[model samples]
Target: MDHDQINNQSRGAEGKDTKADGAAVAPQFSRDAVFPGEVVGEVTDLNRQDLEKQKAAQGSAHFHRLGWKRLTVVLIVEAIALGSLSLPAAFATLGMVPGVILCISLGLIAIYTSDVVGQVKLKFPHVSHYADAGQLMMGRFGYELVGAMFALQLTFLVSSHTLTGAIAFGNITNNGACSIVFAVVSAIILLILAIPPSFAEVAILGYIDFVSIILAIGITMIATGINKDSITTAPWSAWPQDGLTFAEAFIAITNIVFAYSFAICQFSFMDEMHTPSDYKKSIWALGLIEIFIYTLTGALIYAFVGQEVQSPALLSAGHTISKVAFGVGLPVIFISGSINTTVVGRYIHGRMYKDSIIRFINTKMGWITWLTLITVITVLAFIIAEAIPFFSELLSISSSLFISGFTFYFPAMMWFMLIREGSPFATHNLWKTALNGLCFVIGMIVLVCGTYASIVEIAHKFKTGAISSPFTCAALA
Candidate 1:
């Protein structure tokens, strides 16, 4: 079947049509399809303008704008943004050895799943977002469920970024303003930046963010190394007595996985690339660089700071240098997060404006609608950030609840569901079947176990004296 026919058939509201037997089936989208004006087919001249508009809306019309260099910078920034945030604390809590092992392991898993996403996208060019992928697998219902969950996941991630920004601001300002106020300030700033549509614009900020993340991490490492004496505790001492349980340990592991949490953005990134073929290379570059950085940063900081390492890690650096690190981090504090905000906005705008009369590019109403939607999302995320103000625990909850599925299971499921289409019992499909199935199962475990553990611990922190009331200035730094 051709692409449009597949989309039409999948728009049914109920379950997908199975064969006479019980096996699942997939849409007949080709994997190795090339660019526009290629051998895939021809476009009708009657609707040529509409087709171009559709291509622009879908992000393929601006392909050559983001070459391999720009995309690589974007991927690098995305991968390392949050990775530098919380991994040291994980290493501190889990002990250097186990924590490093888990960090590298999750990085490898991320690489494999990320590669899976690239493969799936190469096969199905229509999948510009996770929602599109779900639709291909299960029609309208699939798109609704996946889109909701995917948006929810990205929303929480944006909230996490906002919360982190609030903490960063609070750290610098020393509670001159309440954390809630800082969160709102950060949100408003993000709202303005996100108003201009298109990943191409954000990719420019991404280039700036790339430098910020690197400098921030590098300076933090230097300050920590030079002032190791200030940390009071030895670098590699087993802090079993600092009071962490196995559940908390697992939560730490999840946070490390959270550091590699850019999988959710891969489809959006690929969709905007000048040549989608360059994406696999970008994925490998991001995966390897992040693994090295996560391992090195986590081990080095935890070694020097020990249990003193904070979530942002900037806090535990030598006093003057901590300030410098935080200042350097300010770019990513807004822009890396703008990346998430941009992705979420694109998903919503794509859905609302795709086929509607309001989608007309020449209309002022379309621009107004787009700006209004982005503002609302940014505010809603701001509110959530203040409500769940605990930075580390919030990261844990977001990762366990959503990141596991997007970063691991969804890609695996996509591969398994589409690779063989309806041929479940084919001998040729057996090895792929086992691998994808196993990864899917692992994703589920991460979701279930990690969620339960994070929630329980977050509650315990609230009940005990460990955490303050939500929406407080309370020195979250």
Candidate 2:
């Protein structure tokens, strides 16, 4: 029988009010009836499409309408929120020369990982579904692990942002209001962000872009001029002491990469775009611009602020104006980005647990669960920040560990699986096996060394009186 005859018979099988027992029946017109060869054609087309999509998705390509200006704005927001805040620490760990080089190199890596490889994953429908990347790269177990990791990361990140928000609010008011204001304001922000509003509704995104850049640039100028004058009379030029080695420097660089690169989140966001193909070009452009910004900021901080300062001005004691900018700026980026990240994390987690006894874990529950988890995490962040002298250090170390596992380790393993499953056919680049393996190996080294360094520093601080909570802030002082 022809394809039309088969479809007509299938439609008639549902008892559509058609009077043809021998002849082909014209089924009642419904939305799905416009296409005649619906069932088999759909199944065949979907499978073929998915197969092609999987290949492209694994490449981490993406498509969209984001032009240079919009991309730059996004990078500026990210730079201020995540990169600029950590510039001082990077300089402290790597020194002026190595630190500048490391920042440039890692910034490039971050760009490639996020814009290039991550974009491929973002372009195709269903293929780029955050957890599906795990499945594609690994298998069922990989999917579960990615889901769990994402859930934890979101919980911790949201909490950290809330803490930052509370602290910023406290700075503005200066009445030690980080506690009450932190919880209430952060919860409200999360609620607003979690509703999945369009880019138009994300007014804070623009605020974040404007405020972060202004603050960073303003502080760089003031701090440079002031610190330069102070350091000029001192005559100590031999790379201010930090007591770090080559291996330590290498691990430091790795940690910086983990800090700057959020490719996993970038890949997952592909679903939000109307066109995924924009990824290949846009990501490269975004990465290049971000790298320049990050490199310049790091170099400026190192050259002006010197290694002796405890933290970045933004992190430490910014001028009243800069402080105000940072105080408000950090929270806007935090809540806005975290809400979207949480939504993705929850969706992945719900799917993983959907078939278990906890079958009620749908999208609605995902949001609720994510919100509750975020609230708890936020409280912990406040307590930790309040009590621990080295809380930022600990947070950075933990974040690195999280990225190492989720971004570096799991993806590497999955790519290996792809090789095993279909050799050259499954993954176009046979070299990925070697490249991914190297990343996994290097990641493991960073994980072990960085974690140990963090623990040791925490122990030292505890022996003294630097911090009250070891777990809350033990990375280093």
Candidate 3:
């Protein structure tokens, strides 16, 4: 599964630039793997064979190319996309005290688990994706298991964005167009924007997505803050009202977790860094930013709007603010969806083509193949988005089924397995072992209980007709 074995259709112009000759060259493969299962290209300092060193010498611009700033923006956008929107509603459901506590606590836990991923990569520099980490611990089965889980997680994420993007469109248009039309429109946009061959190529556009969300939320905050007098809000009730249940609250908790469920991405990000040491800086920077944003945004919005605050919290605004905010947020929903789609696409492209990705990137047929995958993925996401339009329910189910594994379970396994591998003869460190065990148990609880809660909630929504049916003209707005 090396470059030579793949269809090197454009093999003649091996080392030349496609633009210089106006012909796609055979990719001069790079030794710098951006994590094996994830998107790749950059050069690495690590030693390999002489052949690889030659390949590294000739790699294109896309490989191992990200610096700390670009990496930070990418990570922040991924975390902030769909998950950050629900924090206000989470606060409303769990009360300000518990909600803030969860926001800080979970954000910290997410950082710790992210650090665990970094450590795992440090130990096994070749590890590329979640499956690569899994394979290190349990061979082929582990690789497939973890790989499929993450692929599914990314797919679920893309679908969630599709649903949310359509909602955002509806929210902006006052439900003028059918949501299904918006979904298709959003899907087309994602496919076109995701044409870049690697995440590194997309890094430059990260700021646009980030700005879109900031303006969107900032507008909502300003609009709501100005009209505080008219807003009706509940006193912080210690528990749910008679009709609303704790299941609803946990779903909110799951939403916050969903916001921080970024462990699955650490591998890909780390692989692209020019200096691996900068990764610690990236994680800490991300954690601090999220803590401030999540707590402040959630508390302020919830305090003003109280228990009736919508999941996105944007929707709880006055009609004008809601429309303006969602319209402003347009780039984020689409950008975030495209990023996730590319992550899924990268994993598949790497698996199918292995080390031949650079060659794939250099060919016209390769771009066609990539576009085809993107089109197919968007179609799938569209169908799912239409079928389950409830935002919180979709987030919760994704969280329960995969978030825990991505953020907690996989990291703990990496920690424990790495420790044992480094010191096979030494007695296991009791305190470290206990801590990892605790993390694993917590992850399992969230996965099992949270999944049951989300499914039950989705079922209830269906039975009560609280959500729209597939392809309906009814406003999901």
Candidate 4:
């Protein structure tokens, strides 16, 4: 059968016909077909139909309202954040040429992997999250494993933002309060912003989040350019640092990898798209935007500040301008951070109430559970942020361990196991197979080498008393 025929049969088997009251009326799939491990079961279709009914009943609670533009906005909210700020430091380590090359090349690879993810989602509409895709690829074991990774990675993302927020507050207020207090305030703001569970609703905040980061980065660039002459006259290099170690280099590379990890949440976001096929538009838009922003931010900031550039290039902008940049960037930090909580909350909420209208979050009970879940997520993230009171290492470790799978290897595997149409050795599929092989290799390399580098560096920092004690009031330098 053709692809469309297969899809039609699949849908028909899973009860495409539903009553107005959201009851499944069509014949169910055979037990053998449903449990064959190649497709999702009938229960998922019922849940989906039920969700549609709930969405229709609660008009404003609809989840499938995102268009391509809004999809891009939501992705930007997820992808671009403190990661951009860290690029300058990455650039400083790898030097100008490699930094720019990695920024462009890795971005292209990420775009390809994201396209594969979107294709899988379109093919299997029931795959609402990465974990669901995992189930399709590797059964129940895959489901649980990917689900845990999804939750932890998103929580790690939120924790990174929490850390960024505290740092921003500390810098903006010039250390006026204890760092722990700043962290608590940051967690509260994140919790509040994450209350809206819908991706469409979050996309609204994405506009402000995007503009906030852009203006902040723009201010930093202008400030740094103006102050370059008066600042340190250390010359920037076009090549890697003279004595960069393996650990140092991989840490920098992993930071760049971390920056392109929008793919990790693409499945979740695309699930909310009104036209899922329009994902290509959003993917290209986000990919180009990230490439431009990261390359420019890394190169310009590194050139201006040379080796003295901070991880967050904002601090490289003169003392006064750094504070201003942080002030302007608060929205992106909190809004972006909160969205992670929302994604995780949505996933958990959907799983917890798959058969109930409460998953839609339009009722009293839904709101209560959602609020409680997000609060718990935010608190856990805050604790993690304190436990790892540093920036670059946390990002590198998260990227190496999780983003490697989600962005690179997992999508590559998806293309091979779920999206490919024929044998790998077929003439038509030769180049694509090779490309996916390369992607898998790259992901594995990052997973192994990058993790080792991050751990080694972090351990060294701790051994040398370079990192502050967790939950300390000491100001971040």
Candidate 5:
């Protein structure tokens, strides 16, 4: 069937009544009345005509074009980037055993929570973003709270990309100019790339992004492996570093947590999917891909470079090859970063013009407002990146403060408030109840301990002058 027919069927399905917990009730239309092909065609055509008229009235912008494959690609574009490279440094602190365990286990939990996110989307088709889901759970206050959290998290992600991009440029050019100049360039590029407001449009770049990161990672791994014998004779440990402190350990764990934060944007991405229920496929595809890449990247790179492995990991591959790796990985860094801006832009723009055609962002006014909003977001991200010059610390603090809720506890609360069907003590509900409880506890621990760890580490770095002053021309590596 065509897009119109599929959308018509979706509308028909959604028209049916649902329970308070979002379970489907009896269908509104009789099956016999819609059974025949000709009748179905007529109904679909009428709905299609109505929709086309609405599209023309509103503008040509369309949101529901993403399929499962493309959705998977978008999730990959958002999820795996600097975080993948950061894993080796985390592994250096946590060692192979804990690192691998956290990588795989947290990945699985993220996948499960993302599945819950998808189910909530499927059930409540009106939830266009995470903030909308928050409203469903806690009214206007929750909406504003989650809205701020969502915006801040995405902004932090953009800041991370901005920082990574500056680092990439500095490494590629061997610090050819002021780092602040590079950061400004990065922000401008992010703003330009974020101009397109559609997730489906962004997914097209995800193809190139996927290839760029893979090639960069492969090059780093090979170069590191080749130079391994010459560099370090020390064997990589299976246990945590001997002097690892509580703060250090938690920061490492939070970095790993940061890597699995794909679930944070699932609702926003799914809002544009034509088949949101197929998000299971996307999450599984993304989750497994992330787990394999993160585990392998962290384990192999740390083993090659030992405890001295750097945050981006590419920097550990020797000077010349590290430059090559950064060049290869540049697309992933910017593209992934820009998508975060697009997401936040869409959210704020949609809210600002919810009852107006400007929400579609295809009109002249829509384009102007969209560009303005994204520019503001990019500038804010640049400021944040400059303020937090340390790489691992920024990621750790952001993950601890925001991602802990977005990836873990929020979804756990979602299960209790919106997704759960029956009593938790019921035979079939017991396991899921326990699982979600664990997720909530995990989120809380990350929020509290991870934040403490990040603050402590940052204070120590400041005290010892280990961190570079903001906007300095000093080399990031």
Candidate 6:
């Protein structure tokens, strides 16, 4: 005759499983007990309406399920398409051995940090995208900073790809028609790629990614084997390898860092993946492939063109083959790279404009502004590449700083934060901490040294009146 008796009576009255006769009817429970809201027995019966609402809610979450194969493919494509062309140019500038080593080292660091970030996102599935990660992990400032950085990276990526295409287009077709053909074709390619919202879809991006890698690797192999004579290097002893100060080494390494900095894309790709567990395995495969390709290409370039050669990748691949491949691959690569950049940038942008900014410029105007800015930068890159024969050097140096920070430093710092904030001991085991520490220390050293070397090189150039400014470049005195 207590609470249990009341519950039993109520169930019986509702036809569940108890007695309902008045002779022993347990005390009539208050209407409040029957239903928490209205007065008396006016409360309606619980029926199909409630069940339907629950089902609908559960159904909405189904879209987030991702498949493992799709994720692996996307990550691999990102790594290969971005890494292949970039490594050759970087190695050419930094010298073969140093260039290859720097890429492998930084790539490993970037991969580890990204894994940590992935784990954090998995822990909080509700806040799973890049913008959310930035805000949740680092706060408002972090969100804004990451967004701006991503936007700039996209601009650089598009510009670089466009220029490479333009150069090849010019070289392959007619001499005078370079700029027009380059700009038009590259822009068209970008527009085509822009049709896809997520750009992670396999049909369009996978084709471009696969074809470009094949052509690039095939051309490189053919050119190197066919023209082996061009690749003979001096003995290790008599090599012009004497008197390279620490500054020189640092500057060279910086160029390599920039070339390899495409690590930020790894996170976006990973997050998009259906199964997060495959992230590490996919990374290892891509890293190993990059290491092998870059190592072989660098060695060949060193042997053939040596230090005196500019743009070794282009030269090593020869005039006809390199020109044709770049002519096609350049536009495709640029467009594909831009998509990844935009995804990262837009993700960041959404996080930043949460308040008034969202109200002000969240329409077509914002999209147009971003596109226009990228177009202008593309033009500037064309002019600069035309004027400065050593323009790749400039790209390598500046990009090194960006790559070092985005790929190595930022990820490591976030890992540190996650560990401190009481992530499971298993996730942040001792070996991981040590590895993260090693990556951080090495990345810092590379960043500092790379900066110093770039400064010295610029100073030397200015003294000789080589490049007057961003707008002007003239012969040395």
The candidate that wins on lDDT is: 4
Residues 1-477 of candidate 3: C-alpha lDDT, one tens digit per residue = 355633352243343447665776444554555334221342333323443544544443455787877777888767777457678877877778888888898898889889888888887888767788889889999989888888877877788777777788887777888778887888888877777756677777789988887887788777767766677565445444556576786787787877887678878777767777678888888888888888888888777776777778787778888888888888888887788888788777768767663334555555677778877877887777777557557767777978888987778887877744444334666656766777788799889889988888989988998875657877765
Per TM-score, what order, best first?
Answer: 4, 5, 3, 1, 6, 2
Q: For all candidates, what are the clash counts? A: 2, 19, 5, 0, 0, 3
| Cα-based TM-score, every candidate | 0.82, 0.68, 0.84, 0.87, 0.87, 0.69
lDDT of 1 at 145: 84
For model 1, what is the error of residue 172's alpha carbon versus the real structure, in angstroms, after optimal superposition?
1.6
lDDT (10s digit) by residue, model 4, range 289-314: 99999999999989988988887888
By lDDT, highest first, what's the ranking?
4, 5, 3, 1, 6, 2
Give me the runs in candidate 1 sitting further than 4 Å from their true place. Answer: 1-60, 237-244, 356-363, 388-395, 421-431, 465-467
What candidate 2 gets wrong by more than 4 Å, as runs, is: 1-83, 115-124, 175-187, 197-207, 231-242, 245-255, 315-322, 327-337, 344-394, 419-434, 469-477
- Winner on lDDT (1 vs 6): 1
Query: Model 5, 137-250: lDDT tens per residue?
Result: 999999999999899889988998887888899989989998888888998999889988888999999999999999999999999999998755566889996877999888
Positional deviation of 110 in candidate 2, in angstroms? 2.6
TM-score, predicted candidate 4 vs. hidden true structure: 0.87
lDDT of 2 by residue, 177-228 (tens): 4355554565456555644322222334645555655565556546555656
Please estimate how well model 4 matches the true structure, expressed as its whole-model Cα lDDT.
Answer: 0.88
Query: Per-residue CA lDDT of candidate 6, range 1-477, in tens?
Result: 355765675576556323555244333445545444333443444523443454444422322244445554555555455345444444544555566566677666555665666666566655435445566667998766665666555555655565555555666665555364555576556544543334345324665666776676567666655775666343212222557676665655554555445466655555555576666666666566556765665555455544443353554566787666565566346655556544544455444443322212223554555454444544554555455544545655656565666667766766777544554255646666677677677668766777667767777777787654332322111
Q: After TM-score superposition, what is the CA distance of residue 347 in candidate 2 from its true location, in Å? A: 2.4
User: lDDT at 361 for candidate 1?
Assistant: 30
lDDT (0-100) at residue 452 of candidate 5? Answer: 93
Candidate 6: worst 10 consecutive residues by lDDT? 468-477
- Candidate 2: clashing residue pairs, number: 19
